[model samples]
Target: MSRRWLSAVVGSLLALLLVPIAQAADTNLGDLSLSSSNWAEDSGNFPGIWDLTQGDMTISFTYDGNGLVDASGAHAWAELGVRSLHSGGFNFNPNSRYTYNTTTFDLRAEGSSTDVGDVTVSSDETNIYVKFVVNSGSNCTIARTRVQAGSSVSGFPRTWWGDAVPSRFNHQTIHSPQVIEYVYTISRSEVGDGDVYVAANAQIYCDTQRNPRSRIVRTCIDAWAGGVPFSRIGDTRYAIYDSSATRVDGSGVWFASDYDWTAGTFGPDPAGSPSLDIDDKFTISRFGGHAEGDYNLPQTPPDPWNNTHFWFDRDDVDQWQAAMWGMAPGVSYNTNGIYHVVITLHATSATAGTAYMTVNGASQGFYSNGWKDAEPEIYPAGMTFTGDMQQLQVFYGLLGYGATHSVTFSDITIGQ
Candidate 1:
C-alpha cells in the first residue's frame, strides 16, 4: 500500500465520523442567542423577525429555520404592542400606528404633544434590525411588550404570553408568516424595577406597515461583516489625502446642526446587509481603534492600530481581520490628485482578512492582508455580533498640514 493511498483512506474515515457530529452539534445549537420560545413554533420553523430594544439590552429573534417563508402556511402574522410599565393594561393597539421618528427612533403620539419617550432602533450588518432597549431607572425597570404572530390557517389563535403583568389584545390574520420590527419608548416608572417582557398577543395580523418610515442606521459594529468602519467622525482627527503625488491634510466643516462637512452616513447600508458605499473624505492609516475612518475595527485584536498606522496580528485570530480606508475622489482627499483608495474592510473566513484599493469604482489591486509581510491573500471571514458592541466615535476637525485644506463628508457607514 502506498503512503498516499493509506492517508486518503484515513482521511475518509475521519470525515465519516466527524461530519455527523458537527452537523448534530449545529442542530443542537438551534436558533441564534435570542430566546426560542418567544418567537419559535414547535414545528421547528421560525417565521418571524421579532426584536426589541430597551437601553443597553438588545434582542434579535432572527428567522433561523428557513429563508423567506410565506405567511400563508406554518407562518405567523400578528401585532406587537409596547407600553410603559407604569401605564396599566395595553397602552395602544398592537396593530395601531403611533408616532415614530426614523432619524432618531423616537416614539410618540402622532397628534398628541405629550412626550412618549425615546427609542433607538438600528440594524446589524445582515440588515436585521435588532431591538435594543435600556433601562434608565434604578429599579430593574420591568416593562411589557406584547407580541402575537400566527394566521388563521395555523389554527384558532396560538398566542404567546409575555413575562410579567402585561395587557392583552386578540385579533386574527390571514395565512403565512410575516416578520416585522416595532420600536417604542416606555417609561421607567411603568416598568417598576424588573426585566422587560415581550410576546405576541394573539395569532393575528399586527399591521406595522400602515405608515412606515425607514430608520437611520449607523455603523457601530463589533463583528466583521462587510462595510466601512466608523459611523460618525468627531472633532479631534483630520483626513489626509494625496494631492499632486503628495499626502495632504484634509479638514471638514460643519454646515448645519445636522449636516457635517462629510455628509451621508458611514457604516453598513441603510437597507441592511453587509456592503460598502464610500462617499466621504478621511484617512485611517491605522486599524482597530479610532482613526480618521467613520468606525473602529473589532476589539478582538486588543490594539488595532499603531499611531495612525494600520496594524494587524497574524498569530491572533481577531487581530488578523481586514480593513479599508476610503475617500471620495473629487471631494475629500483626492481633490487635487487621485491615488489608490481603500473603501472597505472585508473578511473571507475566521483565519484570514484582506484589504483592497479601488480606482474609479474599479479594482486597483488584489486583496492585501496588512498583517505580517503584507502578503496577498483571500478575504477574511465574516462575523456576526449582537448586543452592545461599542459607542460609535466620530472625529471631526482640521489637520496640521502646511496649507489650509477642507473637505466635506457624508453617507459614512460600516458593516455591510
Candidate 2:
C-alpha cells in the first residue's frame, strides 16, 4: 500500500461520528464503558455517543464473538479472530487479535479513525482521556494506544508486553511493516479517568483489513500502522512494532482500552446467556485470565453447556469429558472450544505458572486454544487443576457439567 493510500485508511479510521448520549463526559468513566456482555446485542447502535472517561462503552467494531475468542477461535465473521500473542506469538494472522493496551484489550474502534479527526483528552495521576475518530480509508495501518513495551515504558506495569511509547512505536501505527508494531507508552503520563480527549474526524483514510489487501487499492498504503511482528516475552525489542502488543483489527475507532480478560469482555454484545449461568460462562473463562481486579460477573439465565476437554490417551471413556450441553439453539459452537476464561487466585499458594487444568488426574490441558466447538471436544475425567480450587473461579463458560447444578457446592475439592 502507498503512503497516500494509508492516508485513506487512517483518515477513514479517524472519522468521528458523534453519538447522541443523554449524558455527557461529566460522569465517571469507570461507569461509562459499555457492558461487554451487550457489546453485540445492540447491533452496534450505541444508545448514545460513547462516554469513555465516564466508564466503559459498548464498542462497535462488531465482532461476531468479540475479542473474547482467541486468535485461533471463531470470529464475528465465522472463524478464529486472532491467537493469543503470549502463546501463539504474533504471526499477523489477520483473523487473530484486535488491538493492544497494557491493561487489557481495548475494543472501542466503535467510532471511526478517518482523516484528521477531533480528540478530547483528560489526565490526572495515572491514566489519560483520549477521544478521537478512527477511519482507515487509504492508510493501510489501523489503530492507536496499546502497551507495547516489552517491559514497561517507565515501570507502568503493562497489561501486555510491548511498550506504548518511544515515538517510533506510536508512529508505526501510521507507518510500519506488517510484522512489527510499536506499542510502547509515555512514561509517567497521568491521564484523568473523568475528562476526555477529543480527536474527532482528524486521521487519514485507508482500507480497514486485519490482513493484507485482497485487491490493489491504490489509496491504501501499508505502512508501520500495519503492525509489527509478535515478540517473545524475553526479547529486548525496540524501534520495531510488536505485533504481540498490537490489536490487529483495522476498523476506524476513536477511543479504546484493555480487553479486561478477567471479565472476558469483548464488547457490548449480550451472550445468548449470562454469567449467572456458570456453565454458559465457560466461554468467558476460556478467553481471559485474572485481570487482578474484582469485577462482578453479570447475572443471567443458566444453560446446560460444557466444553470438550478429555484425555485422548484414555482408552476407557468411562465418565471423563468436558462437553457443552447441546440443548440450546442460536448459540455458536466449535469442535475445540470457544471463549477464553480468566480466574483469580482467591485462595492458594499456587505459583503464577500453575494456571491450567487436567483430565482424569493425568493429561493436562492448556488455555491458549481460546474456545472452540470444532473437532467435537470430549472433556477428560477427574478434572484437576494446577492450584487450590475456590468459588472465586471465573471462566467464559463452565467446561464442566450443565446439569441442574447449584452455585452452592455440597463439599470441597482440590488437586494439583
Candidate 3:
C-alpha cells in the first residue's frame, strides 16, 4: 500500500473514534397543521369546514377582550380573537382524538368572538388522550379548546344520558380550561360524531391562581398502544396519581423525612427507618429533617428537594405555610420498615416534561420524559430501585416569597 493512502486511512480511524456518543432524548412539541376549508356562516356561529386549516398539535394563544390570537404560529402575535372552528362529523374518544392525518383546519378568530366556543370535530379513534399546549401572550386570557366526541346512553364515568360516548376531564370545579392531558375512552360499539371547544390561553387553559406553583398544571392519559387492553392508569405504569393508600407515613401534608429520595435496590441513603411506601400510587410525603421528627430536616442533605422541611406532591407550592397551617407539632413517623420516596414532577409546560424527588430537605434530580428507548420510559418497575433516584425537585420561586402558586408533584413511587 502507498504511504500517503495508509496515512489518510489512519487519520480517518482516529476521527471516527473521537466522535461523541449521543444518548436518547426527546423534543417536547407536536406538529399539527390547520385545515383549508375555512368557512363560517355570515352569523359566524354555524360554519362549514370542508378543507382548509392550519395549526400545531400544541397551540400558544393570547386572548384579550376582543378575541384570541395565535402566540406561537404563523398567526403568532396576530389577533383573531373572534375566530373559531367548524365541521360536520366527529369522533368519540373520551380522553382525546385527532383529525385524520389528511384532514386539517384553521382557527378563524374573526367576528362574534365569545369567550366560550367549540370546534368542528368527529371521532377518528377510541380512548383518545388529548392535551393542548397552552401559552399566554397578553396579560389576559380567552383562548379555549373543546372537542365534540359522541354521546353515551348507558353511562359509565358519568351519568348515562347523552346519545353518544360522553366525555370526561372537564374542570367541573372551575370553568377556566387547564393545560391538562385529557383521557377520553370511546367504546368502539358506541362510535359516533363529535366536536370540541377550545378557548385561548387565559380562559381556555389551566389558570394559576396568581401562582403557577399552586395550580394543577396537567392531567394524564395512560397509553394502550403497546398491544395491551385499556385499564385504569394505576393498574399499568408507575406514572399513576398520588393517592391516600400510597401514604405510608404522613397523612394529609408532606414533611421532611430521613429516608433517601433516590431509587435503588436498597432505597434512599442508609435506607432510613422512617420511609414512605406506595404499592398503588407514585408520590410520597415522609418525615425527614430530624428523622426523629419535627426539626429543620438535614442541612446540605444528599437529596436536594429535601432542602425545605416539607416534601410533597409537586403541586404543593407552599410548604413553609404548612407551619402556619400546623405542620410541625402534629407530625408523626413510620415505624414499619425503611420506606423510600420518589417524588416526580410532570413539567406541565412541555409535552414530554420532567420532575424529581427530595430527601432530607434537599433537591435530588429529575423525572425524565418517560422515554426509555423511543418508548415511554418506566422508572425501573420492580421491587426496588437500588440504583439512582428517578425523582426530582424544582428550584423555582415556589419555596420562597417570590414564588407563584404552583403544584409541583406529578406522581410518586414509594417502595422499600
Candidate 4:
C-alpha cells in the first residue's frame, strides 16, 4: 500500500471510542480474591461494575438470585465480555484494544446459589487462556457472549457487539442454564505484559426491563520474551568521510559501496568541491549513495531490529527523475525470517513526484505535501531480506541524475 494509506490504517487501528454506562443501582464486584470459591454479588441491584487485577486468577459473580430477577421474577439472562492490552512492538499499539490472549471453559451443574458462573485467566510460556463457565439450573442463561480476540469480537448476534457489548442482554434467549462454557487463546507475543480487561452484564425480563453491567476485571500477564534494546549508532551531527568513503572521524558512520548495483556513487561525493556536506545534519545529492551505521559485530543468530524512525527534509521534488529514500538494518547482521519492514518518516515531500521509500529492495510510491507521518510496510516473496547483512543504514537514490536533487537527514534511530 502507499505510504499515506498505510499511515491512515495505523491511525484507525489505534482509535478507540469511549463507551457510555447507564445509571442504575450498580455494584462493584471489587478485586478478585485468590480463592476461586470466593464469589461476589450485587444483591437487589439491576446493573453493576466490577474491578480486579491479578495473574492466573479467578472471579465469580451472581445477581438477585443467581440470575437477573425483578419483583415479578420474569427475566433471566447473562452476558460476558473480555479484552486485553499490548504495547511497544512492530504492529502493536498501546492504546488499541485486544481480546483475551487465551481462554477455555468448564461447565458444571453446581448446587451452590452463589457459584452460578465464573471467569478464569491463566498463561503459559507462549500463550494466555481465558475460561468462562456458566453452571446449569441457575435460572440465568447466557443470552449473549462477546470475545474480542482479533480485529473484531466474534459471537452470535453481531448487531449487539461493537468495541464493547451492550449494557444488557438483548431479546435473544438461550436454554436456561444448560452449562455454557467458552475459552479463548492468544499468543504472549501479542499481549506483552499488558493487562486484560473483562466486563459482565445481565438483564431480567421484568415488566419495565432492568439491565445491569459490571465494571472491569483486569488480569496481568508476563512480559514478552524478546526484549527490545534501542540504541543510537552515531552522534546527532554528521561525520566526515575520507576519500575511501570511510568515516575519517571517530563517528560510526561509514559508506557502503557493495550495494551500489545501479552503477551509482555508493558513498559520499568525492569531487564536487565537497562531495558531502556536514553541519547539524548531512546531505545526499545526485548519484545514489548509502550511509551505514557501525553496530556491534557478530550478532550471532542475528537479533533483528524491528523498527527505525528518522527525520529528513526534501525541498525540491523536481530535482530528479526517479528518487527514493529508504532505511534498513545495518549491513553487518543477517536478516532472515524478517518478513515485514515498516518505515515511518516525519517529513513532507517538496512536490508530488516519482519519489518512493524502498525497504528490503521493495519500493512504494511516497507522496505527502504536508508534514505528516508516512508509514509503509514492504512484503516480498521468498526471502524478505535480500541484503548481504542486516544493520542500520539510510540511503537515497536518483535514477535520472539531477545535481540539485538532495535530501538532508538527522536523528535516526534503530531498535524494536
For 41-63, candidate 1 gives per-residue lDDT tens digits of 21111222211221121111111
Write down the TM-score of every candidate.
Answer: 0.20, 0.17, 0.19, 0.19
What is candidate 4's lDDT per residue for 1-416, written digit by digit as tens? 89999999877766633345553332233321111111221112112221112111111121111111122212211111111111111110111211223332222222212334544556544465554555445344443333332211233122321323333322222325433555556565554444433222222111111345553333211110111111133111111111111111111111111211122322233433222111111111111132112111112112112212212111111222112233232210112111122232111121101111222334332222322233423211111111111111222111112111222111222211
The sequence of per-residue lDDT tens digits that candidate 3 reaches over residues 1-416 is 99999999999999999999974342212211122112211111112221101211111111111111212221111100011111111110011112231111222222223222222222333432223222234222323333322243222232233211113423222334433322233343443324222211112432335476585443222111111112332211101111111101211112221222233312222322323321111122221122212211222223323222233221111333433321232121121221233333222221122223333223322223421212112222111111011111111001111111111211222211
How displaced is residue 179 in candidate 2, in Å? Answer: 7.8
Q: What are the Cα lDDT values of the candidates?
A: 0.23, 0.24, 0.23, 0.24
- Residue 76 displacement in candidate 3 (angstroms): 36
Assess candidate 2 and give its TM-score to the true structure.
0.17
Residue-level error in angstroms, candidate 3, position 49: 30
Q: Residue-wise lDDT of candidate 2 within 52-156, one digit each (tens)?
A: 222322211111122233222222211111122221122112122333232212112222222222223322233332333333332433333332222223433
How much lDDT does candidate 3 score?
0.23
Clash counts per candidate, in order, are 75, 220, 116, 27
Name the regions of candidate 2 deviating beyond 4 angstroms.
1-125, 129-140, 143-174, 178-193, 200-215, 220-416
Best by TM-score: 1
Total backbone clashes of model 4?
27
